[model samples]
Target: MKAFAQVFACLFCIALAGVSVAQDAASSTLTDAEQAFVDQMTESVLVGQFSVDGRSDRAPKPERYSIQSVTKTSDDNWIVQARITYGKYDLPVPVPVQVIWAGDTPVLQVTDLKIPLMGEGFTARVMFYKDRYAGSWYHGKVGGHMWGSIERQSPDEGSKTPESESSESDE
Candidate 1:
């Protein structure tokens, strides 16, 4: 049984590596327009950076629990730094996030259970322009199958998806 457990562990590790690679690839891809936006973002990063102010809710985010931090590491990868609030709570608590940038702007994939009623979830906003996705990152396993990463995104053409106010302008 010990050998069986060891083999299972090895298989799980290999599978995790595969998942990370796949996740990174999926997040980095972009549509022409999105790519344009990302390009602008990268340029802005070169110039310094912008900002993604505030925050909003994400619909049916792939995540299944409480959120930690939202980080945009690469043009394609975004990391959520936290552990699943319920289900099988892991030790050391890791940072879980939704990988974005591929075809869609990654949003908060989970809600904070600590919030009252609505959980006042992910009111945070992130605007990353340039970031180092290719580097050693914090990695851990969740649900015994999924993997998580913690990284940073450099901001460029800063944007806030959630706005506190709006102006009526004649078009």
Candidate 2:
């Protein structure tokens, strides 16, 4: 697992570098709606709760993801800069995702992406519409459903400390 983590970290860094280059050469081909989606996601936070499968008796756990920015590189490619803080690790991750629209809604698609400190085999279909978000996630043997509201983050709130950050993306 440690070796896998190291390799994943290296790959993630390389992907981020490519994303940066792609962002620079990106054309202004985004539709009005896509631009709006990017604007809305800038400095936003998805504050909501998540449920663990087979744990119906337990209350849904709170989760918040702070998105510093979202940039479209191509027709369906986007990079979301998200600050992930777990335990003593706090790092800004440039998550490259594919965005498919459901009418005017944007759904972020991630498949088997390995994130540093978040483990491998992570798959999620998180959608954003209006000011709400809902998604299904699968990480290894644990899977869950998440839904929440999108809120603008204040300048002072760079990042909120999680109640209990988990290694899972559910955090």
Candidate 3:
């Protein structure tokens, strides 16, 4: 009877440890403020202008980005799925960026982020606040500034479908 009691006590401790591990895993999700930021950014549109280096004389045209989703993988990292329209090309890319906070503001930072067919020198540090975002971008030797407002898209605003996924725009 003494040996049986020892074995049962050991088994009970092991079960408690397993439950603790499971609870820890369940608590690894983002906090409330982080979730709020993610909710505001998802399914939003960024409308802005970008300029190339040494081209200050030309007027900056309109640039548009459709933010499809934002998924938080960890406390400070997130993956953003976006459709970027440049000139006549529409590129859908998954951008992994780091989120840092300055007081109550959230900033998205990307360092040397490479996009397929868009080269490997892309870098951006953008801050989002009050429905607005402003940032600077670098592409190899050419660098520029971008600032825009976030517009939430309604369900009837012609969002991109899965069948419309392509490297080039249909228009």
Candidate 4:
């Protein structure tokens, strides 16, 4: 009976230690302010302009990106679930990116990150400030610049189409 009780105590201590490690691991990666910024940016839309390299004659129009969520995985990495629409292609994907902090500002850095269905050689370094964002993107041999304003979708606005959102921004 004494030996059995000793073994049970050792196992209990190990289980408690495991729980402590798991709790530490579950702690957030972002600071209070940084997490606040991320919370505000999520479930928002980015209205911006994207110009393809060597496409100088193309008219500049606003583009829309629907951000669903942003989850911090590590000290410098986050997973962003967003819907991106370009030309005839629309894709909703989760993109893992690195976040670099300049004071309180957060900049998302992607180096040669590839989306599964999308073409490879895709890279972007985007910075978010207040309600605005600007970035540069590279796709294979083509690259361009993009910047936009972050807009929160109203309850009614969420069900509306992107076209309607674009028009609302115009107004």
The prediction achieving the highest lDDT against the true structure is 2
Encode model 2's per-residue lDDT on 8-77: one tens digit a residue: 3222222221233554465376688877876787777777777778888888766667777777877787
Q: Which residue runs does candidate 3 get wrong by more than 4 Å?
A: 1-28, 84-92, 156-171
Predicted structure with the largest TM-score when compared to the true one: 2
Candidate 3's clash total is 0
How would you encode candidate 4's per-residue C-alpha lDDT over 1-171 as one tens digit per residue?
A: 222222211111111111123223534655786666666666766667766667788864455566666666666766666654433445456667777888887777777666554444556777888888887766556667777887885554335445566678879
lDDT for each of the candidates? 0.26, 0.65, 0.55, 0.57
Candidate 2 regions off by >4 Å? 1-27, 164-171
Better of 3 and 4 by TM-score: 4
Candidate 4 regions exceeding 4 Å error are: 1-29, 84-92, 156-171
Question: Which residue pairs overlap in candidate 3's backbone?
Answer: none
lDDT of candidate 1 over 40-80, digit per residue (tens): 33212111111111212311111112222333445534433
Better of 2 and 3 by TM-score: 2
- What TM-score against the true fold does each predicted structure earn? 0.21, 0.79, 0.68, 0.70
Judge candidate 3 at residue 96 and give its lDDT. 69
Question: What TM-score would candidate 3 get against the native?
Answer: 0.68
Please say which candidate is ahead in TM-score: 1 or 4.
4
Report the C-alpha displacement of residue 28, candidate 4, in angstroms: 4.4
Residue 121 error, candidate 3, Å: 1.2
